[model samples]
Target: MFRNFGKRTEKAPDADTVVPLWPQNGSAAEAEPSAEDRKLSAFLELKSRMHEALIERLNLAVIDKVEPEELRREVASLVGDVLAEENNPLRADEFRRLVDELIDEVLGLGPLEPLLADPGVNDILVNGHKTVFVERAGVLEQTGVRFRDEKHLLRIIDKVVSRVGRRVDESNPWVDARLEDGSRVNAIIRPCAIDGPSLSIRKFSRDPLTLEKLVAGYALNAQAAAFLQALVEARMNILISGGTGSGKTTMLNAISASIDPRSRIVTIEDAAELQLQQAHVVRLETRPPNPAGGGAVSQRDLVRNALRMRPDRIIVGEVRGAESFDMLQAMNTGHDGSMTTVHANSARDALGRIEQMVSMIGMELPLPAIRAQIASGLQIIVQLARLADGQRRVVSISELTGLEGDVITMQDIFIFRRLGKAADGSIAGEFIPTGIRPQCTALLEAAGARFDRAMFLPEEA
Candidate 1:
């Protein structure tokens, strides 16, 4: 049973009638508690009686047919009757809050609904039943929201996984899924999660940031943006490399907007999160095996299949496995404008990672052959990083020129030069030209997407 409600001196004028707490003119006080706060308070009080006979009397099917206002009224009446019978007094605001909370518990994700609705929140981290943390603008802060207990948290996790036709249990204690809104979700429970059931949600932006907006935010300069746009328009094979939470996908999505609308683009991912606005786009997502561990579809299989689909551009969400070989094959074999992301610290490391992934195929291909394939397929690498102050920036832009013996030769056209940290602890840096004009400039010119050669010249020059 839940704990008793704390006593408050203020009481309702009548048990049957509930009035609005805000002023008639619709003015609210600065210190007034939010609707979510009030609902949380009310939920605690009614937690014990949630499954009582009175609550069961309200038919869920009938409730679904009722309008929101009408449903609230019906729920308010029921809550009022329950409170009156208990001989407990509550204010008008408290009565309304109880009704709202009951509805959320029945129809929504309960305590998480408010956090999910907040646009400012970037990520939701549920450590356990009592602790919740939210990332706002890349910085994490503890939130007051909590579940009733471990059981309640598990119930919510089960609800999320089930919606995607997935399950989590003792045998399969971890699951990865995406919300209907495209937010990514990862959950771990029981023995796997030593502390408690852990859930992490990497929320997607409802309104994705554009390249212009990214430039305005100092993620990259105008010259760099123009160069990338030209490269994309010229159908260059590009790979974006970045660390975890470094905005690689966001950068890819923004650059992908430059793709010609008439071109058929196929995007493959483990979970479909890319919001391609193009009219001719096919999104493919990989599937995990069932409880029996059969019928699994991998990204490698999708990449190989996408080639047969006559794709003008193949945009892999990321290449972390044997799919790197297939992606390279597609790019090398008439699939220009292909793009993908990789987890690496720098441009040189990005090539090394791809080589390692290719080696994972267990084939005895010579090192020089692997290097040649990467050199021929990939034209550019855009490396991004999240700075100390939680700001993401395009750190470097390099072109894979060609293979020199066993090594893949590369040259940076642009790089971010870090000056120092500011008083506010933000990293002060400037994106500067590396003074090396890429060999791809000829290709861009041939495609009528040429830019000023001075854009690649050093600032001093």
Candidate 2:
């Protein structure tokens, strides 16, 4: 129902106006519009009129319960009328790349829409008209695509959020939405966001995380990786922790990759981010409230349900709220090797974070009680970080050796000892085995397995 207003700057236009069309040139005088401007104007006008017409026709057809004609013809007719192109052959020739923009809008996804379709792009962020960023190869990079202007950007934002059955406007200027592809989308308009409409899409990988890729990325050296593989194979409840964008999920995926293929795995997440390889993985995602504001499923609910599913293991993408309590309970109960990730700066901080988050679940339990559960439920905490040199490394791998009063005791099994710096000012470090045997591995040995001890051996190995 809205026209292309373009990406907005500080202020939204007054209520009554359709967003101004994208500037043809750097100017918006709307004169003998520049050729590019002319096409955009024509495109927008055609789409607007056709969308109205299609809706009206559909409403009428609904009353009669009659089927509409083929989508191509319907759109072509509308496009021709809008262009008066049957009589303007010149315009028709120029329009061969005919944009059934409206038809695409009304019937299905539109052009330049396939980016949303591809599951790999993992993230789509729009910085303004000229800069688009996507997450590929686990890194964010700028892509070439711009809205005609802020007005055009805002229009696209509105179209996207509206289709998701969510609202974004002056009163509710920010929106959290999910694309049909299950990509999490968030958008903020002008007053709140300094530039134009700002959008962030947290995209999910179609083929999830695998140990093979983790090994290729140097996330863990072969021996360490093999050890984790065996640990998962043994069903040890593990917790991966780190700050934002530190490859926490990636590490969790690698560790979870160790789960036996035949064991039933229940994975839960607020945004469904984990990509597990187990054939028996049952992935569950939480839902936001609907337009009427009902029917919401949270991570805690899924965790509670997973227990009844008789899961051999339960993995939560991350413990963000009260779900932490349920996750801890699940882990302490019967789910050995149950795993999840949390946001914290260090391994010790991860335990505290869990204590705080579990409290968020509204248990109001004593801090020590929470620490006790975490210590017992989570046998290990693997911390990851993206260092200043733009390299993500395993900062520390620590073990939870039970609790002491209100404090959680942890031992750093593998630490990134800052050996020094490279010639280029880049920080150099290696994942050094603390030389203390990991407590969790005793369980492994008892399971009739052996640790990859030689891999941890130094040059002598």
Q: Score each candidate by Cα lDDT.
A: 0.87, 0.71
State the lDDT at 428 in candidate 1.
95
lDDT of 1 by residue, 237-344 (tens): 999999998999899989999999999999999888888889999999898888899989999999999999999999999999999999999999999999999999
How well does each candidate superpose onto the true structure, as a TM-score?
0.86, 0.73
Any runs in candidate 1 off by more than 4 Å, and if so which?
Answer: 1-42, 51-74, 84-89
Residues 211-249, model 2: lDDT tens digits: 677667666666667667767767777788888778787
State the TM-score for model 2: 0.73
Question: lDDT of model 1 at residue 209?
Answer: 78
The top-ranked prediction according to lDDT is 1
Model 1 clash pairs are none
